[model samples]
Every structure is written in structure tokens, then in C-alpha cells.
Target: MKAERRTQWLRGVLDLCILGVLYDGEYYGYAISQRLEQAGLGHIKGGTLYPLLARLEEMSLVTSRWTVRQQGPGRKYYVLTEQGRRVFEEQASDWTMFAEHVATLIYRRGE
Candidate 1:
């Protein structure tokens, strides 16, 4: 039940986090998942992450390209578009304010 609730909460801002990961540079799916986990976002499943990536691509928020290395299978790397950068900056501010409000409500010292 706790995990389910956390998953629901994560869904609300996972896109922003994904964009945050790409803000550094291009990364393939597994690397993106690793970055998210490194940031304490837990492991984002491909079932959730890939479709969201496709949606972001559809919305022009991100772009992807497939790259094949000599030693490994091809990987579709994703990068944040210029529009994605703008959206990330704006929504990140909004999320910050929203989180602050939630924190205030939840952490009030007195009733």
C-alpha cells in the first residue's frame, strides 16, 4: 500500500525527473534509469519509462536517436530539446512551489 501510494506520487513528477536527467546530455534508457535511481528515484521500469519517453518525443519535448556500438546492441539515446529545456525550467519552478506548499502543510509544528 505504501509502495502503491509512492508510485502514484512518482508518476506525477517522473517526467520532470527524466527531463532533469537529460538536462545534462544525451543518455540511453538504462542509463537514464540509473541516473534516476542514483538521484533516489528508485528503479523506473521500462514499461513506465519507455512510453513516457515516446510521449515526450511526440510532444517534441525530447528527441531520440539510435546508436550502435561495435561491442553492444543498439541504444536509443534521448536528449532534451530546446523546448524541453524551457518546459523543464518552468515546470521545475512550479513543482518547487507546489512541494513547498505541501511540505508546509504536512510539517506544521502546531495545529
Candidate 2:
């Protein structure tokens, strides 16, 4: 039950986290996954991240381009679109408020 709820919460914020990372600069799929993991979001697999990237693209929140490397196969890099920047700002504000409210509730002392 607790784990399920945690999973739900993570799912809700995954998009925001992804956007936050991309807001910095473009990154390939594996690099994005590594960044998330390094940020303590845990290891997000390609199975999960790729579809989210696709969805963001479909929504016009992001754009991708393929870049070829001499040592290996080409990689698809993703960048946040202008629309995505606006959306990220809005979502980040909402998350801040929501997190503060949750923290207050969780830390409240009984009167």
C-alpha cells in the first residue's frame, strides 16, 4: 500500500523532473536516465523514459534530433521546446505549493 502510493507520487512528478533536467540543456536518453539516477530519482529504464519522451514530443513540449557518433550508432537528443519551458515553470510552481502543503500536513504536531 505504501509502496504503491509512493509509486503513484513518483509517476506524477516524473515528467516535471524530466523537464527540469532538459531545461538545462539537451541530453540523450541514457544521459537523461543517468542524470535522474544521480539525482536520487533511482534508475529509470529506457522502457519508461523513452515513452515519456515520445509523449512530450507528441504534446509539442519537446523536440528531438539524431546525432551520429564516429564510435557508435547515432543518438537521439532531446531538448525542451519553448512551450515546454512555460509548462515547466507552471508545473514547478504547482509542485512547490503542493510539496509545502504535504510537508505541513506530515509534520504537524497534535494540539
What TM-score against the true fold does each predicted structure earn? 0.95, 0.93
Residue 58 lDDT (model 1): 100
Q: Which ten residues in a row have the lowest lDDT in candidate 2?
A: 1-10
TM-score of 1: 0.95
Q: What does candidate 2's lDDT look like per residue over 8-80, in tens digits?
A: 7779999999999999999999999999989987778888899999999999999999999999999999999
**Positional deviation of 58 in candidate 1, in angstroms?**
0.3
Error of 2 at 32 (Å): 0.5
Residue 37 in model 2: lDDT = 86
- Which candidate wins on TM-score? 1
TM-score of 2: 0.93
